[model samples]
Target: MSFDYDLFVIGGGSGGVRAARLAAAEAGARVGLAEEYRMGGTCVIRGCVPKKLMVFASGYSGAFEDARAYGWGVQAGGFDWDIFKGKLEAELTRLEGIYTANLKKAGVEIHAARATLSDAHRVKLSTGEEFTAKHILVATGGRPFVPEFPGHELAITSNEMFKLDQLPKRLLIVGGGFIACEFACIMNGLGVEVTQFYRGAQVLRGFDDEARGHVADLMRDRGVNLHVGTDVISMEKTAEGIAVKSSTGHDASYDAVMYATGRVPNSDGLGLEEAGVRLGRRGEVIVDAYSQTSVPSIYAVGDVTDRINLTPVAIREGAAFVETVFHGRPTSPDHELVASAVFTQPELGAVGLTEEQAREREPIEVYSAAFRPMQTLFAGRDDRVLMKLIVSQATRKVLGCHIVADHAGELIQLAAVAIKMGATKEDFDRTVAVHPTMAEELVTMKSPTRTA
Candidate 1:
C-alpha cells in the first residue's frame, strides 16, 4: 500500500526516537515522529536526569558533615535554588537539542505536535495534518497521577518539582512509592522541613521488606518526619501556605504539598480504541512480546505498554521493535532480572526476585549482612549498609541480589551482570573480595543468614 512514510511514530520519547532512528538510519526506511512537548520526553526532561541531579545536590549537606569529621575543613552553605534551577534548565535544553539533532541526523522527520491515530495506519496531528504510514508506533509514556482531593490543584507533581520558583521551607510529600520517598529525602537534605505521609504500612511496598524498613528508619533519622499508615484527609490553601489535615487527626501547615502517588499510562485520547488497538484496564496499550498491538500495522512500547517502565527498558523495546519489524529479526525485548534503584537517602538497588518472592517459588538460602561501612564509621556516623543475596538451594544460582547503601545503584549494575549471566553462590565466592570496599560484602558473605 502507498503510504506517506514507512513508519510513523507518535511521541518522541526515548522509545519512539530510538525506533524512528533505527528504522530510518539502519534499515533505510522512511520514518516520522511527533512529540507534543519536549523531544526528550519524561526521563530526560523531568524524570531521571533532573531527579538524579537533585540527589547529587542534596547529598552535599551530608558530605560536608562527613568531611568535617574526616579532618577536612569544609563548611556547607545554604543551597541557592535560583542558581541550581538555572543550571538545571540549561542542561535540559542542551539534552533536548541533542535528542532533536540525533533524530534529524538519522533521517527521521520530526513533528512538534501531538499525534493521534486516525485508523490502523493513519495518524492525525493536532496541526490538522494527516499522514498514512505502512506502520505506526505509539511510545507516549506515562504521567504522574494525582487523585482528586480538596485543594489538589494547589499541590504539585514531580513534573513541576524541577521548575519550582523556590525551595519550600516546609514540604509535605504524599505516597509510598520511590518517587515520594526520594523527594522527601531530597527536600530534607536540602534543608527543608520535610514531612512525608504514606498510606501503606511501609514505603517502597513492592521491595524487600528488610531493605525498605531500613530505609524508612534512616529517613526518619535524617530528619524526614515520615508517617506511615497515614494520609492527608484534606488540604486547604491559606495565607500561610497549605493547611493539611491528616488521617492521624493532626493539623499542620506546609509551604508545599507534592503527590508522587503513581503514574498512569498516556494512552487515553490517542484514538487507540477506535483504531482497534487493545488497551489494558489501566489504559496501557496491550501488545505482544514483540510490541505489536492488536492491529497488525500498529505497535506500542515503553510505558504505553505498561511493561518495564525504566528508560533503558524503553530504549531496548524500541530497538527490538525496529529489529522485529524493519529488519525482520523477530526480536522481543528482555524483561527479566531488570535491576532498579530507589534514589532515597540510602538508595536501594535490586535485581531479580525478593527473598519473599524466592521463598514462595522454591527452597532458597538468603545470605545477608548489615554493617557500618568504613567510610561512614570513620566519620562517626551510625549509618549502616545491607547486602543480601537470595540463592536457590536446588540450582545454587543466585535468585536475587539487593543492596541498600550509598551508591547502591552503581553497585547493582555490575551485580546485575553477574546475576544475569546465571552466576551461582560458589561462583561469587570464588571471586576474591576487594577489601576495604562496601561492595566487597557481595562476594565475601560465607554463610546463609536463613534457609527457606
Candidate 2:
C-alpha cells in the first residue's frame, strides 16, 4: 500500500534522525521527521556537550593552583558565567544547524513541529498537517524529572540550569545521581558555594560501592557540602534568597536550587495509547528486541523506549532498527557490556557488572588500587585515583572494570573495547604496562585484592 512516505519519525533526536537519514539516503526510501524542540535533542543541545564544556571550564581553577605548585606563577581568576553561556548557546545553535543540514542532505523531510501518532501508520503534526506512512518511529527522548513539593516551581532542572543568566553564589543541588554530583563539583570549582542533598545513604546509588565512597570523600575534600541521608523538606522564596528546610532539621538560604532527581521519557500525549501502542508503567514506549512496538507498523527507540538511555546506545538502536525494517536485516541493538561514564569531579567510568552485581552472579576476584597520581602528588594534594577489575574465577574472564580518576571517561573507552571483546585477567596481565601511568595498574597488579 502506498503512503505519504515510507517512514514518518516522530522525534528528530539522535535515534530518529539516524533512522530517517539511513532510510532515505541508503535504503532509497521516502522518509520524514518532526521535532517539537531543537534538532540535536538532549545531548548536543542541553546535556552532554554543554555540560562537558562547563566541566572543562570549571577545572581550570584547580589547574591554576596546580600550576602555581609547579612553580609556574599562575594566578587564578573568577569564572565568567555570561561569557561561557554566550559561547555555549552559540555552539548549540551551530550543532542544531548541522543536524538540520544532515537530515536535509540525506533527503529526509524535516518538520520543526510536534508530531503524534493518529493511527498505526498515520501522524498528525501540530502545524495542522497530517500524513500517512508505511511505518512510524518514535524517539522523543526524556526530560529531567522534578518531584512535587513546596515551592517546587521555583526550582530549576538541568534544562534551565544551562540557561541561567548568572551563576548562584550559594547553589543548593538536590539528588544523588550523576547529574547532582557533577553539578556540585562543577559549581564548587567555579567558586560557587555548592551544597548537595541526597536522601539516600550515599550518592551514585547503582555504581560500585567503594568507588562511590571514594568520590564522595574527594568531593568533600574539594569543599562540596554533601549531605547524604538528607533531603529538602520544603522550600520558600524570601527577599534574601531561597529559604530551604531540610529533613535533618537544618534551615538555610540559597541563591538558587537545582533538581537532578531523575528523568522521565517523553511519551505522554503522543497519541501512542490511542493509536494502539503499549506504554510501560513509567510512560515508556513498549517495544520488542528490534525496537518494534506491539503495533507492527510502530517502533520506538532511545530514552522514550527506556532502554539503556544513553545517546550512543540510542543511535545504535536507530541504526539497528533501519537494518531490521528497511534493509530486512532483523537487527537488535546490543545492550550488554555497554560502557558508561559519570562526569563527576573525579569521573567514574564503568563497563559490565559492579562488584556487588558480579559477586551475586558468580565467584569473582577483585583487583583494586588507589593512589595519588604524580601530578597531584607534586602539587601536594591528598587526592587519589582508583582502578578496579572484577574477574570471574570460574572462567577467569574480566567481569567488570571501574576507574575513578581524571579522564576516567577517556580511559574507560579504550578499556571498554577490551572488555567488550571478552578479555580475561590473564590477557590483561600479559600486556606491558604504560609506565608512570595510573592505567598501568590495570595490568601490573599481580594478585587479587579479595576473592568472593
Candidate 3:
C-alpha cells in the first residue's frame, strides 16, 4: 500500500531528527517529523548543551582563585544570571535554527505539534492532521521525573534551571545522581548557598565507589553542603522562600527546591500500547537490536527505548535504524565500550566495565591512585584527582578506565579509544608518558593496587 511518506518520525530529538534526515536525504525517502516542543529536544534544548555551558560558567569562579595563586591579579564578580541566561538562550536558539535548517535541507516535513500513533502505520498530530507511512520512528525521548509529594509543585526540575528569573540565594538540590551532584557543584560555584540532600549512603550511587567518594570530598571542600542519608520530608512556601523538612531531622528554608532524582521515557499518551507496541515498566519502548519494535513497521530509539540515552548514542541508533530499514544494511548500534562523563565539579569519566562488574565475572586487578594535582596544590586547595584501571588478570586486558579530575571528560575520550580496541595493560605500559601532565597517570601507573 502507498503511504503519505516513506517514514514518519515521532520526535525531533537527535535520534529522531537524524533518522528522519538520513531516511529522506541519503535513502531518498519521504519523511515527516513532529516535535511538540523545541526542535532540538532535551540534549540541545535543555540537557547537555546548556548544562555544560553552566558548568563552564561556574568553573570560572575556581579559575579566578587559581589565578591569584599563580601570582596573577584576579578579581571575580558576582555571577549575573540575567546576562548568562540571555546568552545561553541565544545559543540554544542558534542550535535550534541549525537543527531546523538541517531538517528542511534534508526534505523532511516539520510539524510543530505532538504526534501520537493512530495505529502501527498511521500517526495523528495535535493539529488534527493524520498521515500514514510504511515506517514510523519513535524517538520521543524522556523527561525529568519529579515524584508526587507534598508541595511537589513548588519544586522544579533541571528543565527549569535555565529559565530562573533570578539566581536563588539558597538552593536545595535533592537526589544522589549525576544531575543532582552536578547542579549542587554548579550552584555552589555560582555563589549560591547550595545544600545537597541525598537519601542514600553516598552520592552517585551507581558509579565506582572510590571515584564518587573522591568527588563528594572535593564537592564538600569546594563549599557544597553535601549531606547524605537525608531527604526532604516535606516543603511549604514561607516568607523566606521555601521551608523544607527533611528525613534527617533538619529544617531549612531555601529559595528553590530542585529534584534530579530521575527521568522517565516520553512514552505516555503516544498511543503505543493502543497500537500494540510493547513498552517496559518505566514506559520505555521495548525494541530489538536494530531498534525495531514489536510492530515491524514501527521502531523506537534514544531515551524512549531506555537504552544508552546519550546524544551521540541516539544519533548512532538513528543512523543505524536508517541503515537497517531503509538501506537494507541491517546495522545494529554498538552499545559496548561507550564512554561517558558526568559534568560535576571534578568530572567523572569512564568506559567499559566497572571493577565491581568485572570482579563479579572473573579475576580482576585494580590499579588506583589519588593525588593532589600540581595546580590545585599550588593554590593550597585540598583538591585531589583519581585514576583507576580495572584489568582482567587472566587476559591481561584493561577492562575499565575511570578518571575523576578536571577535564576527565576530555581525557576519557582518548582513553576510550585504547580500551575499545581491547588494549591490554602491557599496551599501556609500552606507551611513553607525556611528562607534566595529569593524563600521564593513565599510562604510568604500573602496579595493581588490589586484585579481586
Candidate 4:
C-alpha cells in the first residue's frame, strides 16, 4: 500500500511511546509518533513524577516535626518554595530529554505536533504534513476535568498545581478522589492550611471503605480540614486570595482552590467524529478486547480507552496491541489482579477485587488485621496498619488483598503476585511470617471478620 509508516501513533505518552518503540524494534515495523506537548505525557511530567517530588518534599516537613519524638534535632528545618520548584523543573526537563532519546534509540520517528486523524489509516499533523499507515494508534491519554461552575476559571487543575510560581499559603482542594486526597496530604504536611471539600459522604469513594476511612483519619490527624458531604457551588477571587462558596451556603477563602475532582479522556480535538470512532459517554474511546476500535485498522490504548488509567497498565496494553496487530501474535492484557498504590501519607496499596466486589459473586469471607506498627510503637504514635484478605467461598481462593501502611506499595506487589497465581486463604496462612516486619501482619492473621 506504500504506507509512510507501518504504524502511526498519536500521543507520545506511556502507551503511545511504548507501542511505537516496540512496534519498531520487535515487529521490525516502521513507526511514527506525534506529540504536541511534552514527550513523557501525564505521568512523567505532571502527574506521577512531580506529585511524588511534592510528596517527598512534604514528608521532610513532617519528618522534622516527627524528629522531636526521636530526639534527633534541636534547630528548625525550613523549606524554600523557589528552591523546590527549580529542582522539580530541572528533573522534569531531564525526563523529557530521556523520553526523546528513547524514541531515537528505538528507531521511531517523532513528530512534535498534534495529530488529527483524517481517516482510519491516515493521520494529518498540525504542521500540514499527512502520513498514511497500516494502523493508527490513539494514546492521547486524559486530562484533569474541572467542572463548569461559577468562577471555575479562578480554580486550578492538577496540571497547573505543579507549575505554580509560588507555594500556596492556604489551599482549598475540592473532590475526594485519589488526586484530591493525595494533594491534600502533601500540601498539609508541608504546613499549608489545607481544606478538602468533597460532595460525597466519603473521600476515595471507589476504594475499600476501611482504607478510605483510615486515610481520612490520617488526613485529619495531619491537620487537613476534611469536609465531606459538601459541594462547592462557586469560587470568587477575594482581596486575600480565592473565596469558595459551598452549595450548603458555607464559604471560605484560600490562597488557591484546586479542583482535583476527576479527569476526562483527551479525546477532544483529535477529529474522531469525522473518523467514525465511537466514544463512551465520558468521551473515552471505545475499544475491543484486543485494543481495536470499531474500525479494525485503528486501535486505542491508555486513558483514552477508559480502561485502567495507570501508566504501567497503559504500557502493557500498548505493547500487546503492537504484538497482536503487526507481529500476528494473538495477545491481550490481563487486567485482573493488577496491583496499584496511591501515594497518600501512609500509602494505600491493593490488588485484585475489593471486599465489596468479592462479596457480590458468592458467599465470601474477609480476614483483617489492624494494629500499631513497630515503628509507630517505638515512637508512641497511634497510627495503625490495615491488612485485609478477601477469599472466595466456592474455591477458597484469595480474590483480593489490601494493605495500608508505610511500605504498603512494596508489600502489596508480592500480594499481587500471589493473587494472580490464585493463592487462597490457606496459602497466606501456610506462609511463615517474616518477623520484625510490618508486612508480616498480612499472613499471621487468624480469624475471619465476616462471612458473606
Candidate 5:
C-alpha cells in the first residue's frame, strides 16, 4: 500500500534515465535510478559516438588520397594512433559527466550500483540497500554475443574493441551485421588489413540484395577481404599470428579477431524470475504495448525489450512510456516506415519496405535511378549513387525509399518524414526537385525499373 519512491529504475542508460527524469519532472514523482556501469550507456560510451568518430577519422585517409586529384598535392605524413585515442578518451569523459548532470538537474536520485528486483515492487542494489516503489522499470539494455568456437576466447567483442591497447595491423571480423560492417570500414579505411567473414550469403541480410552487392563490390575495391557464406570453425595462434580456419574451407591470418555476430538482451543476473517478471525468447522482457511487463507494477524498455535496438528508438520508447502513463498523454511509436542507415564508405539509407518485402503482396511498381552524382563529376571521383522508390500499384502510395551513396543518412531523414506522413508517389513528383542534389533522383525517377 505504501512505497518509498514513486518509481525505481534499473540501468542508467538512455531508456532508464529518460524515464526517471521525465517521471520526476512531469509527474512530480520521487524517482531512484541505478547503473552499475557508466552513466551515458552504450551509445555515448562504446557504440555510436566513439564509432562515428572512428568513422570520421578513418575517412580522412581517403580524403587525403583524393586531395591530389583536387590538385592539393597531399602526401602521407607519419600518423600516430595514440593521439587520436587520447582525444577520443577525453571526449567520452566529458560526455559521461554531461549525462550525470542531466540526471541531477532532473532531481532524480542516482545510485552507482547494479539493481536487481527482489519482488514485484521492490529493488535491491549491490550495496544491500533495498528500495520499494509503486513501480519498477528495467532498462538494462543488451550485450554483444560472441559464439563458442575452438579458441573462441581468443576473439574479442565490440566492447573490448573499444578499449584495445593498440589497433591491430591485420584484423579478422566474423559476422555480417551493422557493427561488423561499420568496424570493418573503420579499420580498413584507417590502413588496417581487414578480412570480414559472414555466414550468410549476404552481409546485410535484411537490406536490398542489389544494395548489398554494390556495397560488397565497393568494400572489396577499397581493399577489404570480404567472405560471405563462410563460418569460422577454429582459431589457432601461431608464431606468426592468429590463424582462422573457416567452415567454407578457407584459412586466414590476422593480429586480432572480432566477433560481431549479434547481441542478446541483458536480462541475466537481474533476478527477474525472483521478482515474477516474465521474459520471452532470447531472454527479452515480455512487455505490453505500453512497455509494462507481465507484472503490472513492473515495466521494461530499450534494448532489453529487443523490439528496436537503436538508441533513438530506445529514447523515444522511454519518452512515450512516461507520456502515456505519467504525463496524461497517450502515445506509441508506429515502428513502421522507420529510416535507418549503414555507415559504410558510400553509406546506405532506407525507409519503409524493401522491394523483396513488398513483392509478397499484390504487384508493386519499383522505380530506381543509378548514376554518378554531380559532386563526384566535379570532384573527379568514380563513386556512383543508387536511389529507389517502391510504389503500390493500386494505391500509388510510396511503399519504400532506399539510397546508397554519400549523405544517404542525412537524405533519408526527410524521406522518413514523408513516409510517416503517408506521402504517395504523386506527392514526390509534385514537389520540386533540389537541383543537382543526389537525393533529387528519388523524386525524378520517371519510369519504373520493373513492375512486379
Candidate 6:
C-alpha cells in the first residue's frame, strides 16, 4: 500500500511526540503528528507543570513563617494572583514552544489541528487533509472529568483552575484524589479558606493507608476544612458565588467550587470502533503488551490505553512502540515498580505496593516512622512526616516504600530504582543512615512494626 508517512500520530502529547520524533529522525521513517490545541498536550500545557508551579507558589506562605522562627525577620505579603497567573501562562507558552521545536527538529511534520482515525492505517485532520500511513498511533491522552449534576456548570475542573483570573477568597474543592487534596493544600497555603469534600472515608484512596492518613491529618492541621464521608449533593449560583449542599448535611457558600473527581481517556469521536479497534468500558483503547491494537496497523499508548498515566511512562511506551513496530525489536513497556508522588505538602512519594495491597496478595512486613521533622518543629509547628517500608515476608524484598515529607517526590524517584531492582529489607538495613535528615529514617528503622 502507498503511504504518505510510515507513522501518523494523533495527539501530540508526551507519548505521541516522543514516538513521532524517534520514528522519523532515528528510525528514518516518515512521521506526522497533529494536535488540536497546543503542542505539549496536558502535562506541559495544563496539568503537571502548571500545577506544580502553583504548589510551589502556594508554599511560600509557610516558608516565610518558618523563616521567622529561625530569627529572620520574614514578613509574608498577600499573594498576588495576577502576577503569578501571568508568569504561569508565560512559562507554559515557553514549554509549548520547546515541544514544537523538538518535534520539528526531529523531522516530524506537525499539524496544528485535530486529527482522528479514518481507518486502521489512515488519519483525517481538521484541516481537511487526509493521509495514509503504514501505521497509526493514538496518544490522545485524557481530560479532567466532572460528573454531571444539578448546576454542575457553576463549578470548574482542574483545567479551568489554571486559567482563573483571580484567586477565590473562599474555595470549595470536591473529590478526595491526589488532585483534590493537592489543590486543597495549595489554596489553603495561598490564604484561601479552603474546604474539601470527599464521599470516601479518606483522601488519596489508593495510596498507603498510614501515609495518606498523615497527609490528611497535616492538611486539616494546616487549615484545609477537610470533610471526608461527605460529598456535594448540589451546587447553585448566588450573589455569594457557589452555594454548596453537602450530603453530610452541611450547607455553605464559596467564591468558587472545583471538581477534581477524575479523568477519562480521550478516545471518543476518533472513529476507533469503526476502524475495528477494541476499547475498554471507559473508552480506553485495548492494546497488547507491545501496544498494538486489534488491527495490526493501529496502535495506542499513554492514557489512551489507560496504562500508567505518568508522562515518563507515556514516553517510555512511545519509545517501546517505535522499537517494536519500526526497529523490529519486541519490547513491552515495563510498568512494574513505577514511582509516583502526590504533591500535597509534605508531599507523598511512593513506589511498588502499599501495605494494604501487598498484604492482600502475600505475606508482608511493615515498618513505619512518623515524627515531626526538625525544621517544622524548630518553626514551632507540629507538622509531622512519615516514612514506611512494606516488605514481602516470603522473599524479604521491599515490596513498597512510602514517604510523607518535603521533596518526597524527588526522594521516591531515587528509591524507585532500588525497589525496581528488587532491593530487600536486609539490603536497606546494610546501608548506613545519613544523619539529621528526614530520609535517614528510611535506613535507621531497625525493626518491623507489624506483619501480615
- What is candidate 1's TM-score against the reference? 0.99
> On lDDT, who's better, 5 or 6?
6
Off by over 4 Å in 6: none
Cα displacement (angstroms), candidate 4, residue 104, comes to: 0.6
Candidate 2 residue-wise lDDT, 286-309, digit = tens: 999999999999999999999898
Tell me which residue pairs clash in candidate 2: none
Candidate 5 residues lying further than 4 Å off, grouped into runs, are 377-380
Instruction: Write model 1 residue lDDT over 1-452, tens digit each, in one string.
Output: 89999999999889999999999999999999999999889999999999999999999999999999999998777999999999999999999999999999999999999999989989999999999999999999999998897777888999999999999999999998999999999999899999999999999988998889989998998999999989888899889989999999767999999999999999999999999999999999999999999999999999988988899999999999999999999999999999999999889999999999999999999999999999989999888999999999999999999999999999999999999999999999999998889999989999999999
Using lDDT as the measure, the top candidate is 1
After aligning candidate 2 to the native by TM-score, how far in Å is the CA of 4 from where it should be? 0.5
- Give candidates' CA RMSD values in order: 0.8, 0.8, 0.8, 1.2, 1.3, 0.9
Q: Which segments of model 2 are wrong by more than 4 Å? A: none
Alpha carbon lDDT at 22, candidate 5: 91
What's the TM for model 6? 0.99
lDDT of 3 at 146: 84
Per-model CA lDDT versus the true structure: 0.94, 0.93, 0.93, 0.89, 0.87, 0.92
Clashing pairs for predicted structure model 3, backbone only: none
Residue pairs in steric clash, candidate 4? none
* Model 4 stretches with alpha carbons more than 4 Å out: none
Higher-ranked by lDDT: 1 or 5:
1
Per-residue alpha-carbon lDDT of candidate 5 for residues 284-366, written as tens digits (9 for 90 to 100)? 99988889888888989999999988888888888888887787788885566778999988798888888998988878999
Model 3 vs truth, CA RMSD: 0.8
Better of 1 and 6 by lDDT: 1
